[model samples]
Target: MTANTRAPQQERSRATQQRLLEATVECLVEFGWSGASTTVIAERAGVSRGAQLHHYPTRAALVLAAVEHLSERRAAEIRAEAAALTGDPEDRVEQVIDMLAAAFTGPLYVAALEVWVAARTDLDLKAALIPLEARVGREMHRLTVDLLGADETRPGVRESVQATLDLLRGLGVANLLSDDSHRREQLLAAWKRQLTTAIREP
Candidate 1:
């Protein structure tokens, strides 16, 4: 009897934590870091302030957890999209670039940017973010290499992969102010051609 009751309570706790983390991301997107206070996040999650603190004792903790949660979800989505690609090597490269560009301009990226900017001055947040960012970067780079079927042992192949990510990230930044989609599309097209050449082995 006690075991049955405990299992349900544990499940409910997990559900509530998930809601809080998700709400934190929404708050970051809508309000930016400064406005995404604990109260606002708790309210957004439809949970009490006490519950928010119980799950995440501080604003930085909450925001970081949210970013990490959303990042994982985004990575899974990218993986699924990658798995669905059926094409020639060059075609797959083009599709991967397009997929990455779309991801960089999405809401999760915006929330991450907010946290990144805030972390620039917040030592605690910066310390926490460093490892998470490194892990995410390595995962993205590895996935890109795998999807492109690139021979990293070949000269310039690894750098080309890194450059592709950097370019998409710059475009994502450009998109923050206005609709940079027109310019982004053109730039991506040109880069895709260059990337195709750069990643192709002799």
Candidate 2:
């Protein structure tokens, strides 16, 4: 009942929620969707089943929250890297492309891929994921434009930005089966040249 006691309880609840989200991602990556049950995630998080349900209620909820949580974290990291870029503006553009490339290949992408595949057959999950994906995609596009100082008003500039995202997403899909890093770097290098030209044209 005391304020002090309530604060600690709230902090612990947040911590548990965080742990469950992390564990859901890990389960998806390691066990796939069918394997990432609520029970499994709770066990992975070292939290009780009751606690896990209290936070997320269902597997889809947990997985979606995990994806959203990690997506924000990843985007924040990209923004921070963009802030720290030095040297010529053109060079900074290249760095931003590389940062976006890294985002596609990271753990978050891997976990989200698992969910994407599962959502193909699960209507409830597909419904939840559609809006989340749309929002994340918009944020990424906005972030990319901001990082590149791109003028969407310019002809082809918006398309060029969208193409960059499409390219990165394709590369991420290709990377699932094997180490596509070498091929990915080659493709990204080529796309950067094209993107730079597209966005820079008068």
Candidate 3:
């Protein structure tokens, strides 16, 4: 009887935590770090401030947890998308390029950009965030390599692959405020051609 009750209670606690974390990301994406106060997060989560504090005592703690949650959610999404690809070479190239490009421009990137920009001045936040960013970077790199069957061991292959992601990330960040869609589209097309050519190296 006690075990049955405990399991349900534990599940409820997990659900509440998940709601709080999701709300944190929503706040970060919409209003940035300064606006994502604990009160606002609690209200967004539809939980009481006391309940939120019980889960996460500090702003950095709450936001950092949200970042980890976002990384896990996004990585799973990328993995599923990668697994669903068919084996046609031309189709795969287009699909993979589109996936990588889309991944960098969406809500997940916006939420992360908010945290990264805030972390620039907050040493404590930076300390907490750097390892999470590194882990996510590694996961993204592995996902890209697998999605494209990239031969990372080939000469210059690894650096080129890293550069591709870096370029997309920079472009994604730029898209936050710019309306340069025409130029972005041109650059993206050029990148696709270059990546396809590089991958076909003898």
Model 3 ranges with Cα > 4 A deviation: none
Model 1 spans with C-alpha error above 4 angstroms: none
Better of 1 and 2 by lDDT: 1
lDDT of 1 at 190: 92
* Model 2 accuracy (lDDT, Cα): 0.89
| Model 1, CA-based lDDT | 0.90
Query: Please, what are the lDDT tens digits per residue for candidate 2 over residues 1-202?
Result: 9997999999999999999988988888888788888888899999998888889887778888998988888898998888889868789779999999898987788888888888989999999999999999899999999999899999989999998888888889999889999988887888888888888888
**Residue-level error in angstroms, candidate 3, position 182:** 2.9
Q: What is the C-alpha lDDT of each candidate?
A: 0.90, 0.89, 0.86
Can you rank all candidates by TM-score, best first?
1, 2, 3
Better of 1 and 3 by TM-score: 1
Sort by lDDT, best first.
1, 2, 3
Candidate 3 lDDT by residue in tens digits, 100-146 = 87878888898999999999999999999999899989988888888
lDDT of 1 by residue, 30-146 (tens): 998899889988998899988888889988888788878998988899999988998788788889998999999999899999999999999999999999999989998998898
Model 2 residue 13 lDDT score: 98
Each model's TM-score, in the order given?
A: 0.96, 0.95, 0.95
Best by lDDT: 1
Ten-residue stretch with the least lDDT total in model 3:
177-186
